[model samples]
Target: MPLEIVMSVSFARAGLILGLGLTVASGACAPLRSHQGYIIDADLVNSVQPGVDNRQSVAQVLGRPTIASQFGAEDWYYVARDSRNLNFQKPKPKEQITLKISFDPSGTVKSVTRTGVEQIAKVDTFGKTTPTLGKKRGFFEDLFGNIGTVGAAGAGGPGGGGGGGRDTP
Candidate 1:
């Protein structure tokens, strides 16, 4: 083969390999989208009318709820979240929907409430340690601070003889 043709072929192969590598690398950085919990269908959700729908009908139309009320009024919550994560980052919610169906004692739906992403709260954590009320102590203090207090007076220790016990002369 001619030297010029040989060099041109080698360069073409290298360019093609480099282009493919770049494409693959770019795809990896793209955001990954995920859907969690109940899948919402506008028509189906709207079809459930208050006062007309009961537990059996609601379950058939919307399936089981994400969570049911543990206290107070009987309610069913259908939660849906669409999240996106780029590369190795934690997934953040891009959209959220919380559908609350409140039922009366007779199992009839009292009301249907829909909440959107506006209800999402963003909480910023301080660090690894939780923020607690009370005097902050050092590592050594936490380890040894209780040494003298364990058997101290009025501590209900073996010799402390709490006030509830009968007095001995």
Candidate 2:
């Protein structure tokens, strides 16, 4: 009976140690945050015809715009943006962008518009300067340089090594 108790205790300790090791290793390999922004309702914009779509009807079709003109009140902005921290790493976009469609006083579509300033990248910039390290690197350099390193692997890692046993050679 005493021997059985000792063996069980030993097994318990081993399991605890293994669990702790796994927890720490997982914590260390958290992914880098990734941000993705794009126009979600582009189809809604294309469907509207300048002459056919009126203010009330357009509102019914596209739901509502994100921003409205405070002064004019005739303009409507339908905007959708998605910014994700795939791992929650660094500072990302403070602003988002979408298409702006305007209506004239007669209630037909007046102008279809977008400003370059507000549109976020569908994919985050890769070749530009990295904010965390404050250094810029070319696209290929960042790709190959970080590949297969111990730090980069996480759940659904880019290389397909950590989460699943299967990986592309």
TM-score of each prediction: 0.75, 0.47
Cα error, residue 157 of model 1, in Å, equals 19
How do the residues 1-169 of candidate 2 rate in per-residue lDDT, one tens digit apiece?
6999999999999999999999988876765443344344667677888878898888787776667787864787766444433345654554455667878888798878766435555565866745575567788988787666654656455564565455469
Candidate 1 lDDT tens digits, 63-83 = 999999999899999999999
Q: Model 2: which ten-residue window has the lowest total lDDT? A: 31-40
lDDT of 2 at 85: 37
Give the TM-score (vs. native) of candidate 2. 0.47
The parts of candidate 2 lying over 4 Å away from their true place are 1-13, 20-39, 86-91, 94-96, 114-169
Kindly report which residue stretches of model 1 are placed more than 4 angstroms away from their true locations once superposed.
Answer: 131-169
The residue pairs in collision within model 2 are: 65-77, 65-78, 66-77
